[model samples]
Target: MKVTRLLGSGVELADGSRIAAGTVIWTGGMRASALTEQGSGQRDPLGRLHVALDLSVTGAAHVYAAGDVTLAATDDHGNHAMMACQHAIDMGRYAGHNVAADLLGLPTMPYQQPFYVTCLDLGGAGAVYTEGWHREVKLTGADPARSVVA
Candidate 1:
């Protein structure tokens, strides 16, 4: 049921089937790029490289991975980083810092993002905003829209 393209009124599936509708909301999934295969490291089912606390590739020396390519622990509660910009941005920052720190012979900091939030657009119905990994709904309907504008 993979979506190959989003039509003006609907979506086209990978099987070449098309569905017509008035609205379509696509929350695409993520997968690591082919470049990750070139590295010698353990990969998750999604092909994300298993990374150390310092964001370094687990089995590759001096090589670091970040963003959607690496699967790093987000916190001590066993939550791993997702392949989203929210996690990727912070992962990139930590990876950059750790890489420089490694080269300079300085202690590198562990990557940690304890807080998580999600804002999902519902098209004409407005949006939904949630906080934390449990996804506790903080706002809905036009409230999320107003908050975004404000």
Candidate 2:
């Protein structure tokens, strides 16, 4: 699918809904709302159920989170993905490592996300891989090579 780089609060259609926090809220395939203000006291009680990554799950550990939903957390353990598939792949690997390390009592790994990549299909026969989801995508850093690295 083709995605557009929305500016400002985000792009919306004829209606009045908005998507903020870089999330794409859609209606019948059109963007309805985007995150204008991320983690604005929005809490999902359900998210509290996710298992936390602590220094030790054996009831003693220094667990922490670094992501968008940290503010809205009702309890512990809440985070948002990279909003891109590349980061998903990266996070998947990191999650596996954490599980193995914690289970085997092995060392833990640090989370390091490079960036994001997007494939935009132009017209009928052209595509571009960008590093970010903004207008500055054409800058020196947004080169296709950077996307390939992701």
Candidate 3:
């Protein structure tokens, strides 16, 4: 659902429906910043630059992209990193290490995250926890509460 506008305590949808709530958490998704357009490189549909394993911009020498600005391979099984905080955090770390390694003539490590997990909060109904790209449910209700609360 696309939000047409943000109300005082909720959101108006594109279809002209209004939802009332005490709090609204919008996870509407994101697009890469226009700063990426200033550079020359292949970009994904979201405008993220396609990056090499070491987080360097493909076909753009000495240029690196990470975080939400990059489209990167996450593992050998052909999984790609998503534009989420979880992926961005690790990508940032890898980009930092790889950039320093390249400058100091050290071997750079390829970015890889084979394991994936997700926790979705359902508010008063509690939450759900899943694993893998397919989002296989591994926990729910009290299980997620116990695992995520800490």
RMSD to the true structure for each prediction, in A, is: 2.2, 11.7, 3.1
- The candidate 1 region of ten consecutive residues with least summed lDDT is 21-30
TM-scores for all predictions: 0.87, 0.39, 0.84
User: Tens digits of per-residue lDDT for model 2 on 103-149?
Assistant: 78787775554344566544334446555434245433344444454
**CA-lDDT, candidates in order:** 0.90, 0.41, 0.87
Model 1 TM-score on a 0 to 1 scale: 0.87
lDDT of 3 by residue, 1-150 (tens): 678988897889899999998788866679999898988798988999988889999998777788889989998888998888889999989989988988898988888888888899886788899999999999999669677877
Clash number for each model: 0, 9, 0
Model 2 alpha-carbon drift over 4 Å, by segment: 1-80, 123-125, 133-135, 139-150
Q: How does model 3 fare in lDDT?
A: 0.87
Q: Candidate 3: misplaced stretches above 4 Å?
A: 1-5, 12-27
Highest-lDDT candidate: 1
lDDT of 1: 0.90
For model 3 the local lDDT of residue 111 reads: 87
Arrange candidates, best TM-score first: 1, 3, 2
Tens digits of per-residue lDDT, candidate 1, 19-112, equal: 9987786556678998999977899999999999989899898899999988999999999998898999999999999999999999999999
Give the lDDT ranking, best first.
1, 3, 2
Once model 1 is optimally superposed onto the true structure by TM-score, how far is the C-alpha of residue 139 displaced, in angstroms?
1.4
